[model samples]
Target: MAAPTFTDAVVKAMKTLYPPELADSAWDNTGLLLDQALLPEGTESKQSEGAVLLTNDLTAAVVDEALEKQVNIIVSYHPVIFRALKSLSNQDPMQKHLLRLIAARVAVYCPHTAVDAARGGLNDWLCDIILSETKEAERKVVQPISRPLPESLQGLGYGRTMKLQGPMPLTTILKNLSRGLGDQQHIVLKDADAELIVTGEMDHHSALRYTQLGQTVVTVFHSNSERQYLTQVLKPELEQMLSQSSRAEGRVLVSQADRDPFETIDISSLGS
Candidate 1:
């Protein structure tokens, strides 16, 4: 028996779970970004046979970790290299990371928006989380807000909207949302209407207006590429792919250090 190469694992995984052609957004940069063969000499062997690191975003720190751990492939949920780079110079931090990964012989693969809109991907997982938390009386009605790029890609969309059964108290709704998101105090409740009018900086101090139509309370939740969902939703798929592949020993690991870059603070608490 022979160990499967990185390309082999990626091909099998893509065919089974996320086909880059079928899953990628028109503007997305999915599929293989960097190949091990393209790396500098004495970096690593051409064969990709090591642990796979799964991360939402690929940073220089992550590349360092991959080099230290001898990780051959990085399955970044978000594409690290987006847009055309005029040059790979030290002036640009992203280019620096690219050069680092290239030198380390690490292969980069990104699923990006393709995974978000996949049949049983991020958006569906997020929708399930919110719907699961709602009480029976809440009678959640969930629908995808973003239309699919093509008509054939039905049920594939970015965000979804859930209409509550009845008008929920603003506080209660906030609490439910907080619990669902795993953060209570840091949740941002903004009035979308006011956002259009007010040009200045608006924090938690800004008044929140809950849009309501008759007995139903409507709220929209937008996910900013949070990696937490990837750990829960994509892990099983990756594991299954690995098990089915020749390289059953190849492990699919979610990066422990990955987190949302932005930190939220409750401005209301500052006043008290």
Candidate 2:
């Protein structure tokens, strides 16, 4: 099929997360950027043939990159523009970025918190990654899982529920989760006598109760548990999109990003 129009792809991605009918009132910003007519054919002066730039943080530097690349559509996981707009002064960074995009006929779109909580957005993807098996010497083993990232949360966001599937021991699961979450010390282990449970953020009362009960309960720091969603979910999705685009165009133009910003650890460091 002809590559879906940029706007259409974006709309499809959003609908994947939030059905217009099911979304809450707060998710009003989960849609396209400015109209198609205002967008330029290719970005100029930090513009392109209307390419779309996607990222977790919509910082000034990122905006500059988008302009430099002449991107027509910017699909940021985080909303670059927030708060009520009192006015649009060129002095502010975001305003400057907005002005630059507008001047270049680029349209910036953000798919914040709404996307995170979506079914296949952040949480669901993370859950799948954790459950996936890693291969070693032809043997496959399950890997530990981590929570999604700030951008994914802002873009898609998530809610928590207690049900889980798997037969791994609770202690092993907690350790693996810690590894996945960047080894933050915030995770606490409790001993509840019967069933074990894991919570993303720490709760003292719950910890104490679990400890008293002898259940092996663990709590994850809120920030750590949710920081990798962008790397884990959005990046892969974009890669797939870019890959398909490249194949259809008969060129190796668009490609997957080499690194994820949230994983402070370098893959190169492992061999050393």
Candidate 3:
């Protein structure tokens, strides 16, 4: 039998922890999206084991970081190949990055919504962050899985809603949000049907609609909402799972380049 490659180990650990079945497959393209172990068109296979790099997205910069670090696999939280592609071409930046990744034989895997929907996954972690100020709260799934899974994942869902123990001031919640997400620059934490809604994003009109209905909406700016979980939760979990799976020994590192694209600027400072 062939030795388990590093890519194989990472995939196994991801699937075991965040089963693809838990993902919202209708729109999400999760699991091993790239496999260096499969070998490219004309070249012989290179070393199949190296370090793991975790990132929220697989951009060209992240790819460069992966190559510099000589990682065998990247556990990106978002899929680079999100839309249906007719072909790969350098003219498009993301496609160019894909080609580059392929050339370097750096495999890519994404657990996107699986991580969100899995019990104790990103959504749960987000809840912990949002409610960390409270002594206790009742957290319930905002959307339970439509697809069935084993009993082990009975309550897995994509988002969480919490009923605070006591009527804590919203200012305290805002302070906790800023502290928890490490979003020092933005103080605009504010969302759900269950009382408040916290998400990576919400369109302006939708946010207005919810607010009009007396529900608070908090938008952490998509990738920003997901990035910290990769560092705090996924990194440690992958490390533990990798150690258990015995892929021999390899380092699991988070990418420094990965970040949310949107930033709120203080343009008034320009007047100075």
Candidate 4:
């Protein structure tokens, strides 16, 4: 059988997995951004046949990789073209890639916050992973901080607030979180009240904050998007989508080139 060519039908099928209407924020840009261009005169749609490439961010490197691998579609978890752009030009890196994608005729789709707030989505996945590290005796109650108002998405929400079985010191909690979340992650711990009142350079530099609330210690952990969770949880669904679309073994390729651009630098290493 011939390889399945990407079509509007396939894109529609993919959207059913995480509908754009369920996105947490109204500002989010979800769903299909670009579509496969029509073939030239005398050319066949099958000529554009290729596999799907998944990435958390559609960086220029991912675009080059897609072109090299002959990927017909890109499913980026984050919107590549966000905010109002005055114009598309080489002056901006994102614009350059947009032009490249257009020239190559590759379709781009971003699920964004839809996947984050969807049932069994990113927020839930993150909460599950973190809780998995704790013993059952240690976790008292775990629930979403705020749930979606929609009846269909009752349990789905933006973040989770978990109550420990017993009061734990702020340092101990941070240590446990570090172990679960990984050492490389840049985590900011803040007292919920202080977070609202604090401002200036000191806010950015603080790694951990402690507050006394009688016998209880509470801290909020804020992190940038962790792509690893999305890659792990979404792979199976992506594979199924590909299998159904192509009528073959699904080949969902996660980009190995993806990485967090920010890095923690130890300036102390430099001689003072």
Q: How high is the CA lDDT of each candidate model?
A: 0.60, 0.52, 0.75, 0.60
Tens digits of lDDT, candidate 3, 23-51 = 87766788888887455458665543559
lDDT of 1 by residue, 22-80 (tens): 55455677778777655454654743465788887887777777777777788887777
lDDT of 2 by residue, 1-272 (tens): 63555545545544554454433335445455443334344732433342566665566667667656655566665566556688889889777767776666666556665554566755554444344342343123333233432332332334433334435455555556656656554456665546654545445765665567666665564434444555555555654654454222211112123123434455888995
**Which segments of model 3 are wrong by more than 4 Å?**
37-48, 136-157, 189-194
Candidate 4 lDDT, 20-111, residue by residue in tens: 78775556667887777756778654423546788877788898888887777888877787688888897889888888887777888888
Which has the greatest TM-score? 3
Clashes of 3: 9
What TM-score would you give candidate 2 relative to the actual structure?
A: 0.57
Candidate 1 off by > 4 Å: 1-4, 22-24, 38-48, 135-157, 161-177, 191-225, 265-272
Sorted on TM-score, best first, the list reads 3, 4, 1, 2
Show model 4 residue runs off by greater than 4 Å: 1-10, 44-48, 84-87, 135-157, 162-186, 191-224, 245-247
Worst 10 residues of 4 by lDDT: 194-203
TM-score of 1: 0.70
What's the TM-score of each model vs. the native?
0.70, 0.57, 0.85, 0.71
